[model samples]
Target: MATLNLGILAHVDAGKTSLTERLLYAAGVIDELGSVDAGSTRTDTLELERRRGITIKSAVVSFPLRGTTVNLIDTPGHPDFIAEVERVLGVLDGAVLVISAVEGVQAQTRVLARTLHRLRIPTLIFVNKVDRAGARFHELLDEVGARVSPALVPMSRVDGLGTRDAAVTERVDLLRLADHDDAVLAALVEERTPPPVRAHDDVHPVFFGSAITGAGIDALIGGIVDLLPTGRAPGRGGTVFKVDRGPAGERIAYLRMFDGVLRVRDTVGEDRVTGIRVFTDGGTQPRAELTAGQIGTVRGLGHVRIGDTIGVRDAKAQQAQFAPPSLETAVLASRRAELHAALAELAEQDPLINLRQDDERREVYVSLYGEVQKEVIQATLAEQYGLDVSFRETTTLHIERPAGAGAAVEYNKVAPNPFLATVGLRVGPGDGVSFQLAVEPGSMPAAFFVAVEQTVRETLRQGLRGWPVPDCAVTMTHSGYSARQSHAHAVFDKSMSSTAGDFRNLTPLVLMAALRDAGTVVHEPIHAFTAEVPADTVPAVLPLLARLGAIPLATGAHGIDGEIPAAKVHELRRRLPGLTRGEGVLESVFDHYAPVRGKPPVRERTGPDPLDRKEYLLRVVNRRLTPSQSST
Candidate 1:
């Protein structure tokens, strides 16, 4: 059977999960309908998700539609878990974007719609919650056209909406509407057969429905099967998008097979698939094989990580970059030694939860999107790992960039160098952090090239500002190794040795010297935000935003667009509700890094400063001096 990978995306509380449950019921995949409020939905199985009535992670479910298999991916609508949505977007053949009939187009709705459009994923819009009071189809449709895309054409019109028996009637020629490129229209005029809807087309077919009452669901499903295109055959390669643990504590890699078949025990790269499980109406069933255009879980892939491509050596799965975590908090635990171990497990699930250790402070820090995510982490630890933990006050995570350009060199064979390698490098500002090994033939053995390049890239992790450096370029202008020379071993002969370790050790010293000469500037992450408020409150909100260093973009009758420092978003979130009498809507997304205008707050250093030559060398090379001893 042909397969289709469809994603369900929406703004928070827009009935996205409800819509998924309805679709599953409509397809007869489930005997009874599950409600999001009751926490019985198939896609949302997490305890935290059930309790909170929100989807915290993307979940995949499959069911038969007509003669085709539809692999549905239900993505988290909450902005905090947007990373989950981003991971699934790379694998979708099409998407059903859910919008609330009552709420009209929301900030997140626009974000999702624009992203789907930009990615060129053919999308259908579902105006859900038609049963809710204040639901207006015409107004919502206009809002969608104005806020989302103008090319959105209505597939049907709802009569007696917000009632028990709302009826839908076909309003447009779907074949023509789906003919976004006018190919179908041309075919009709030329007396030739019109083609099926192209999945990459810009035109979006909008469907009106109430997911709760199951109104207008059949039409939506029919639209999907008839209008959406069946994807090409899967390739042998696929990307691991999620990692979980089975009942036996074995690793489970959730993958979207792009091409080729993956069989049980098939060795893809270095990892072997010990087992395969494909989703079915009756839960996952063990499968001997998985073909292309399928989403399934595989076991025994211990080293596989999110965004890793299976069956392809050294290939990286391309995914949309998520916004950097703007806030961080210290993890407070009584069992200090076990904290890192527990966090490592959490990091395996959500790589965005970057865990850092502060040896000097004897504390653990974690990156976060906001306070809600912090609470989730705290709860996750207590529930899953049985480790109770609290968090200190949150703080901003700052990054640095190069201010100029310079060069440095380290000759390992010389006295006091304490190694058998020679390295030289140059540093300058670039669009982002990057490394290149520019070497002349015979300058170094071919075997040493990879080691030298890897070492340089690793060393760039730390910069003079005590944060990961960004927007800088490093190139290895020179590299060498000591010739085999004999030295007295015991009382007569000498020995010679050359290893990659020497190059790795010397890398820090040379790179730091270059960074110091080049100088560095710190930049803080900023966010572009939009706020919808009462028309009368726009004036009041303007000055408040200005006080927070926000630059106004546009002032509409009931909304304002602006940019603000991400660090101050929490303050805005706390105050916006009361200012607009609970009717206001505020949305913020990471924009770009801007240079700190004045004195910047200091951040805790992660490692020894490379500029401190003697201390760094003693700490890294000698390994005898403790952190305190080396500093002293």
Candidate 2:
């Protein structure tokens, strides 16, 4: 049977989980429908998700449609869990974007739609909640066209007058089909096969449905089978998008195979897969082999990470573009010793959590998406690890860049210079963080040159500000090696004196001197936000926006769109509802990093100041410096 990997995405509370339950039920995979409000949904398996009535992580379920096996990934709609959504996007063949009929297009809905369009994932729009009162089909359709895309073609329309009994019927309007692709237009002219709604940039087919009553579900399922593209035959590669622990504490790697069959005991990278399992309605079933376009979990790959490609050791895994966490809070624990180990376990699940420790202050810090995420982390630690923990006050995570170009040199011949390697480095601003090793042709052996370049890149991780250097470039301007040493009788020694470790040890001093000479400028993260409210609330919200250093992009009767510092978003979330009498909706995503217009707020230094030569050299020479001392 052909396989299709379909993803269900939406804004929060848009009946996304309901639609998934309905799809499984209609396919005979489930006997009864599970309710999201009752926390009985198959996709939401977490206790926290059950209590909060929200999806905190992405879940997978599978069912048969026609002769095809459909693997569905129900992604979290809440913006706080966007990282989860991002990881799934890289593996989907197509996506179903759910928009509530009553609410029409929302902030997160637009975000998801734009990302889908940018990623060029062929998408279908499901206008759900047609059973709710005050749901307007035509008006909502118009809103979708204006807000989402003008390329949407309605494949079905609402047949009932009221939402309570609304039904969907196939009624393709010929007049509305003109703006679609040539393949679709030609199919209409020939009156042969219906134009294929391909998974591409153009022509998103819209379907109206009430997932609660299972109305219009048949059409949606049929559309997925007919409209969505199937995966190519298995090749020799795939990507690992999720990592979890098995019931027996073994590592599990959830992978989406792009090509090639993966078998039990097959070696991927350095680790061998001990087992493979595919998802079923009831749970997982053991499978010895997974083919192309299939999503399955593999065990015994302990060193594998999310986004790692299996079966191909040299191929590069596509990096997921996720919004950086804007908030930072210190992690406090009752059992201080076990704190680091517990955090390492949590970081394995979501690398974005970014756990850091400060030896000077003896404190731990974690990066978070928002306050709610912070609460979830606390709850997770308590519930899963039995570790009681709380967070310190939240703060903005800032980054810095080089203020100017500079260079430095370390001479091995100098007295007490530490080793036999001589290195020189130059630093300057670049598009982003990058490194290159350049030298006069045959300045040194390739082995020594490679070692110097690798050491330089690793050392550049932290800059003068003690934060990971951003928008900077480093180059190896020069390198040197000592000639073969001779004994007192003029007999040559067999072993070479220079090593990669020597360059690594001397790298900090030279790189630090270069950075200190260049100086630094800090940049703060900014967020583009949209606030929806009643007309009367606009005036009250504008001042609050101004107070938060927001720059308005557009203002209308019902809402305002603007950009603000990400640091202020948590505050806006707290104040907007009160100002608009609990009727306002606010959503923000990381926009860009901009130079601080005034005196930048002081940040806690994560490492020794490179400009302070004495303190930095002493720490590096004494081996007191650690790799984790720098914040990224």
Candidate 3:
């Protein structure tokens, strides 16, 4: 049988998990639907997810829909967890964008749509919860068209049963957005377009109704089966997004196959394939072949990295550069001692974490997520690695920039020995925000050049004010090394020791925290949400939304039958339950990050402790060392 892999995405609490459950039930994969609130959802099996009632990780499940085996990946809605989404997106055939009918377009919805547009992935919009009160179908449809794309067209409409609390009684019609291709356009105008051509059009289609009522699920499922592309041919392939270690210590790499067929133990030239697994709404099952356009996990090849492509021998020829995990936070032990080795191991797993040492201060720095992820790291150490550890409060991840165009560093002599390697390197802003350090060798040995590069990378970790440096170009010229030095230990120590003085005068600036594209503010994550409440609570709820910077999109009697007012709020409101008179429920996901509004009240940091203070002074002194001008 052929396979199809797609993603289901939406804002948090937008019923994305709920809809996944309903889809599984509707397809007969599950005996009954599971509820997110009840913590019984099939995909949200993580302890953190079940406790919080939110998806923290992406999940892949397979089901038979319209004679096709569909692998659906459900992703987390929180912005903090977007890395999970980005990793999963690398391997999907297409996407199902779930937009809440009541809440409409939100900050997260906009961010995600822009990401989709950038990738040019084909999309289908599902406006869920149509049976709920105050569900604005046409107005929200217009919002989707205006904000996301001009191509979204409705596939089905809901007709009300009556003014009473009657359920959604009828589906008026199923429509498809007109195709963009000229051949189809000409055929449609001349009445020559085939029926199947009209049915499986490339235009974006929108389906509406409640996942609870099963009002329009059949048509929605039919459109997905009909429209989503299937890769039946061989030679198509994709890169692995995220890798997980199973209970038996096997590494399973989740893959999105774009253009080829993959089978268990199939060797594509040098690379070998072994353990292969496919997950379904039912459960995980072993598979022999995962052809093009399908998503699944491959195992046994422990050497594979997250972004590696599997198929042809020269896989890199067909692969695109993947942005490795950038967002990071440090997980530190309460005591300052175990910091070094702990960081080394962390770097092995996530090299992007950029773990480095502050020799002067006798401390270490590591990049990581928020407090919760930090806790996980500490726990992982104690539970898995048998190390007891406590953590400190999390801080913003910052990078360093050059104060000006470039700074020159010359390395000449070592501390105890007369050994010398003279060099000149100019450091400036490079292509991206990440700094570039180069060593143009004059007479340095190959091993010495390699050592210098590694040393420079470590020293570049934090600048004068202590922030990781960003994109800076480096040029190495006029350098000579001692033949007596056999390894990196000597060269690494000498290079870093010499560059200390120049780094001080060169002056480094801190690159402020910001999001890509949408200029960043020290924005905290907000959950765009909706709630159903008794009309009397409107007076109370209105004030709460305004206080939290949440904008209300729609509020009125939903067609779900009742006087209950369905209202939408844009930002987080933990106190919402108290304001509503036990009548309404909420749906929300992480919105975009925003600037920390207003003058952040200032606070002074207590100077480093005695040991840290002593270390800082040594760092200051080291910055003064300079090789004589005549050394070159």
Candidate 4:
């Protein structure tokens, strides 16, 4: 049977989770429908999610329909938990972008649609809540076509819309899909049944339904089988979208295979798959193997990382289709050590949190998307890890980029370079962190070169101003190594031969000098926001937004669309409800980074500071400093 990994996604309160429940019930996987209000939804398994009546984690459920086993991933709708949605995107064979008919098109709705279009994932638009009052059908279609994609084809027309008796009548327009391709157009002209396949990006089919009353679900199911792509691809690797800890505290990796087979006991990359649990029509069944186009839980990959490839990799298997957290908050806790330890483990599951420590001040910091995410993290730490932590005010997470090209080199046995290895590097701006070689591969031992390159990257983590320098082009300009020299008698000797550790110890000093010469400028995160508010509140809101350094560009019936610094997003959110009498709905997404207007905020240097020459030499070369970072 063919398998399809479908995603059920929407903005918060758009009924995305309810739709997931309805699909499961319609497929007979569940005897009855589960309610989001009652906190009985199958996909919302987390207690936190039940209490908040929102999806916090992306939960996977499986059901069978029309000879296809569909693994429906119910992803979090909160933009705060969008990292969950981002992880789920790369694994989807097709998606159904849900919109609230009463709400029309929302800000997060627009974001999701744009991303789906960019990825060219085959998508179906579902205008939900047709049974609710204030539902608008034709207007929503016009809005979707104008604001979202104009290539929308309505598969069915709504009858009795905006009432409890709402129904969907089948009304396919074969001609509407003609513009998607010439072949389909020619087939239509010749009165031939055109090929059923449609371009994922070019043409989109729209469905109207209500998850509450189960109206129009049959048509949606048909769309799933008819419109979506089935996974039967060739190749031999999978993408790891999620990771969890087992009962024994071991890592459990949730992998979606793009192609080929993976069996228990098979070695994939550096780890072996010791156990497998495939999500099938009847729920997770422990199995000996996992095949192409299936998602499963694999155990015993002790070092498996999220987004890392398993087996021979293809481009789709390793694409970093994720974004980094743009805001960070300092966690203040009485049990600071425990909080740090817990955050470290949490970081393993969601690496974007990027736990960092201020060793000197004994403080812990965690990155976040917004205030809601900070709340979730606080709640999680309190309930799950038993640590009561309060976060400081959120701040923009800044990063530094190399200002200019600079080069530096240290020769082996030189006075300042005490290590018995020579390393050289040139730093400059690039698309992202990349390392190339000016020296031949045969110039030194591969391990030594590996050591130099690794240290160069590690050193760049905390640049001259202590902000991360993740984007730069680094080239290894020179290399030298001590030949293995030993006495006639085969005896252990450390003074004669250069170890990888020697290259590691000396690389920081050389790379830091290059960074000093190159210089850097700190860039702060900027976000674009769309706010839907009462028409009367726009006058009051524009000034408040302007005070927070927002540039309001367009004004619609809802409110204003503009760009604001990410640092001000929380403030905007806090003040908007009051200004609009609790009717204002604001959605914001990270746009880009611009140079800070004034002095950039500095994060206290952690581990060893390579910029300090005497301290770095004393700590690294002489081994006088306590082990800051174990590179050897």
- Model 2, position 537, has a per-residue lDDT of 82
- Across 219-307, the per-residue lDDT of candidate 1 in tens digits comes to 78888888887773233578777888777767788998888788998887777888999876636899999878888999988887787
lDDT of 3 by residue, 13-104 (tens): 67789889988998888898888888999899776678778887788888988788888889988654666777665565567888877777
Better candidate by TM-score, 3 or 4? 4
Per-residue accuracy of model 2 over 1-632 as CA lDDT, tens digit each: 88888999999899898999999888888889998889999889999999899999888988888988888999998888888888888788788999998877887898899888877788888989887887777777778887898777787888773568888887655435455456667777887676545546667888888899977888888789888887732335787778887777677889988877999998877888899998764467999998777889999898988777876522322644566777789999878778878788778888888777787887888888777888888899898888999888998877778889989887875543555788888999997667677777487777777676676665554566556665778888868867667789988763446666667667777887788788888788998888988988888989999998999898875489889998888789899999999998887777778887798665656555445555654666655433433211
Best by lDDT: 4
Q: Rate the local accuracy (lDDT) of all candidates.
A: 0.79, 0.79, 0.57, 0.84
Better of 3 and 4 by lDDT: 4
Backbone clash numbers for all candidates listed: 13, 4, 37, 0
Local distance difference test, candidate 2: 0.79
Tens digits of per-residue lDDT, candidate 4, 1-632, equal 88899998798899999999888888998988888889998888878899999998888888889889999999988888888898888888899989999998876787888888877788988889999999988888878887788777888889899999999887766565566468878998999987765538778888899999988889988998888987733346887889888878899999988777889999876788899999987589999988888999999998987887776655653455445788888999998778888898888888889877888778888888878788888898888889988878787788999889988998987656667988898999987689989999999899998898898888887888888898899999989989888887987578989999999988988888888889898888888898898999999999999899999989987689999988888789999999999999888887778888888778678876777776766766666543433221
Query: What is the clash count of model 3?
Result: 37
> Which 10 residues in a row give candidate 2 its minimum summed lDDT?
623-632
On a 0 to 100 scale, what is the lDDT of residue 529 in model 2? 86
Worst 10 residues of 4 by lDDT: 623-632
- Between prediction 1 and prediction 2, the one with superior TM-score is 1
Give, for candidate 3, the lowest lDDT window spanning 10 residues. Answer: 509-518
Task: Estimate candidate 3's alpha-carbon lDDT, on a 0 to 1 scale.
Answer: 0.57
Q: C-alpha displacement of 501 in model 1, angstroms?
A: 2.1
Error of 4 at 64 (Å): 1.0
lDDT, model 4, position 502: 94
